[model samples]
Target chain A: MTGQVRTVDGRVAGRRGQATRQKLLECLSEMLSSSPYRDVKVIDVARMAGTSPATFYQYFPDVEGAVLELAEEMAKEGATLTDLVAGRTWTGKPAWAAAEDLVDGFLSFWRKNDAILRVVDLGAAEGDKRFYKIRMKILNAVTNSLTDSIKELQSKGRVDKTVSPAAIAGSLVAMLAAVAAHQKGFQSWGVKQAELKPNLALLVHLGVTGKKPTK
Target chain B: MTGQVRTVDGRVAGRRGQATRQKLLECLSEMLSSSPYRDVKVIDVARMAGTSPATFYQYFPDVEGAVLELAEEMAKEGATLTDLVAGRTWTGKPAWAAAEDLVDGFLSFWRKNDAILRVVDLGAAEGDKRFYKIRMKILNAVTNSLTDSIKELQSKGRVDKTVSPAAIAGSLVAMLAAVAAHQKGFQSWGVKQAELKPNLALLVHLGVTGKKPTK
Candidate 1:
């Protein structure tokens, strides 16, 4: 578990400091949604939080540092994604259900934190290791679980041995993440949201089972 | 075909003016790769182009305007992606080859223009219609062709009738784009670039033909 929240000066944040820090994060989060990451400034976040810029600096070195702090918080919540795949059977009706649940769960999570995830994705794509590590922290929770499910099937000869579980799982997760990020793109492409989800579930089922789903 | 290039003021750019304009775009494109999109400025691009900011203004309204011009050029190149699927037969070995070639072609194109494409992606994801349209112009060139191929297979009963060709094709193209955008992420996950391509081809072949490739 994460230790107590601390200020930039290394002092553990007291209740008042923690409250101010949380307010600043909330304001920063809003700025990320409304404006591009590069345009988000500490002064703006501080003004929105009704605090001084010096106080903002006391909690975070810079905007990127605060964004990383926000991302770490989200990564902790991402741990819940394990339930979407762990212990889920990939056979018959249950397999169909599993795919649907996974797609639904994954999409909802991405939608909820899309603003931060976008910055994380951009930073990671730009080769920033800090952002990349945070992205992996969030995605690996679900990806590792799916990889295990695929490997379990491979062991029983239910899936092909030539198929790399890690690759397939990673690809499928990438597909899900991409689709979730561009849900509006799909809608504009003439595929409705309802129609889009089922097809995504179909692809997930196909990727995991290597066969058309029974449903 | 596009008519003669024009400045933001609606004047047709002559040879000398066009050269300055193109230089500004080239400089802006380089800036996009080297710096974050939000931080890219018209003044810097103009300075790098060895011209005044007024010259940059004559050619483009803002950084985003110049970026849209660049994206337009890339979308024209993306039209070539249609050849990866348009006339290719998708039965048996030919299907596998088609999938491999599509993956190869798409990944190379993405890698070549990733920096601009990243901004375009961010713009589109932020609901900017101009950027979204350009993105569609690029991806639709492939997605529409893949959709037709799926529909063709469905007509012959090679693909299931219940499947939505648009959805399946969109998902596959999204997968390719996502994978291309994050090739390094795969490498870091122990799935090398070499390993990643074949698995992507397999999924593409499976999604299109609904069966394992002959290879």
Candidate 2:
């Protein structure tokens, strides 16, 4: 569990302080959704939160620091993505359903946190270690579980012996993330959301089971 | 074919002007690699190219405009990616080779143009039409070819009838791109580049053919 939430100046934040910090984060998140990440300023975020810039600085060093906090929170929520794959059977109709549920959950998660995730993605791609670690945290949850599923299938001779479980799982997870991030692009390309989900689920089933789903 | 080179002001660029413009672009590309995209300034690019900011403006309206030019050039090169999937068989052992070649070619191309491609990816994710079009142009080269290949297989009864060719092809291409962009992330996660390619190719083959590769 996270320790006491502390201000940038190292003061332990109480209930009211935490509420204020959360409000600032919520306002910052809104700003990220409406404006380019480069153009988001601390002053604007403070104004939007009905607080002073000094209050913003007390809670965080700068805009990037606040964004990192938001990313960290999202990554924690992303950890629960493991439930979408872990303990799920990858056989017959159930396998197909599992794939569908996983795709649905992953896509929705990305869509909900897209603005912050986009910034995290850019920072990670730009070789920032802090952002990279957070990205890994979010992705590794689903990826590790999927890797286990693939390895289990391979052990039963249902999947190929030569397949690298981690690689396949990682690639599939990345695919899900990429497609989720560009859902609008897919729509513009004429693939509707309803059609996209099934196709994605089918591919996930195919990738994991190495066969077409029994559905 | 592209029309004659011209400046932001609409004047045709002479040989010397073209050289200067190319140099400025090259410097801008270098700046993008070494610094955050948000921090890349026209002044810095001009200084690095040994030109004035006014000169930079004469050629490019702003950093983003110059980046679009870089992305445009990269997209042109990316069109050649079609050759990786076009006319390639999707059956038996050759199918495995086809998949491997596609993975190798795609990964290398992404690595070569990662700095600018990262910016394009971010831009497209943020709903920018120009960047989205460039991204579509690059991915569509392979996705469309792969779609045709899958449809051919479906017609021959090799691939599943229920599969959506465009959806599968687009997802697979997106997987390749996401994997390529985060190659370092995979490395840090303990997946070797040598091991990663074969696994990616396997998924590509499986998604396209609905069966594990013969290899």
Candidate 3:
């Protein structure tokens, strides 16, 4: 748990204050979805939340601070992505199913928090440590789980020893994240969403299991 | 060829005009690397370029327009990426080498134009059709070639028939691009650049051939 919510001035927020803060975040989230991150002014977010700019400032220092808070919340939710890979069997039809589920879950999670994730991705890519840490938190959930899967397979001689489990897992997770973020762009290339999932799943299975899936 | 360079007013740029425009773009590109894209203003770019804001406007309608121009230029250069995949064999030891070369080439390209590419990626993800088209133009060069390679393999019955070549190629290329853009981030995950390349190449080979590389 994140412990007691505190204001920028270091005061613990009461129930009413937390409610107001949550409303501001929801309004800011909506604004991010509708407009560019750079153009989302604090005053506009405050107005959208039916509150004064002064009240907004009490909860957060600025728009980036609020966005970071949103990212933190999403990162907490993203931790559950580990379920898509943890303890999953990488053999036979189940391997294929595991890959399919991962691709599906990842794409849906990305589609859900796309706006905030976009900012997190940009911030991380730009070398901001806070954003970078949050990005890693979300990705490591799945990447770490997948890495263990590959390592276990390698130990059993089911996968190649020459393959670096960490690298493959990291790359595969990155692929899923990238593909999810650009799901719409795939449509423009004449690849429908329905067609993309299975292919992505196929690649995931191929990378992890080092063999064609049994379907 | 892309035809005669023209200003926003539709006048053909002479040699001198072209040089000034190029300088402004170079300056803007530098600003993007050093500052957040949202905070980058035309006045700052103009000041850095040793010109007035009026001169910046003559060549570009605004900062985003100038970024699009830079992205367009990068996309043109990116066409050469087709060489990394085009006509590359997917059999034996040569297949492993091809994968390495493609990964190397893609990563180097992303590093060279990271700043502009970052903006382009964000724009495309935000549903800006112009940025999406430019992103497609760059990725398509490699994606199209890789797709053809997969299709050829599939036709020979070497690759699985159920696999969608475009989707696989797109996913693989997306993996490469995503990993490339976040090469620095990988280090934090304990994946060094030297160690990262071979593993990425391994995944690329597996995805394309559906078998581990003979190497």
- Compared with the true structure, all predictions reach lDDT values of 0.90, 0.92, 0.93
Scored against the true structure, residue A83 in model 2 reaches a CA lDDT of 90
RMSD of each: 1.8, 1.6, 1.5
- Label model 2 with its docking quality class: medium
**Model 1 chain A: which ten-residue window has the lowest total lDDT?**
A118-127
Off by over 4 Å in 2: none
| Candidate 1 residue-wise lDDT, A1-215, digit = tens | 66888998899999999999999999999999998676789999999999899999999999989999999889889889889988999989999999999999999999999999888888888778998998898789788988998999999999989889899999999899889888888987888888888888988998988999998
Predicted model with the maximum TM-score: 3
Tell me the interface RMSD of model 1, in angstroms: 1.3
Model 3 Cα lDDT, one tens digit per residue, B1-215: 77999999999999999999999999999999998787899999999999999999899998999999999999999999989888889989999999999999999999999999989999999999999999999999889988898899999999889889999999999999899989999988888899999999988998898988888
Residue by residue across A73-138, what tens digits does model 3's lDDT show? 999988899899888999999999999999999999999999999899898888889999999999
Best by DockQ: 3
lDDT per residue (tens digit) for residues B17-136 in model 2: 999999999999999999988889899999999999999999988888899999999999899998998899999999999999999999999999999999999999988899999999
**Model 2 agreement with the true structure over A102-211: per-residue lDDT tens digits:** 99999999999999999999999999999999999999989999999999999999988888899989999999999999999988887788888999998899889888
**Residue pair clashes in candidate 1:** none
Better of 2 and 3 by DockQ: 3
**What is the Cα-based lDDT of residue B27 in candidate 1?**
92
The residue-level lDDT of candidate 2 at A90 comes to: 96
By DockQ, the candidates rank as 3, 2, 1
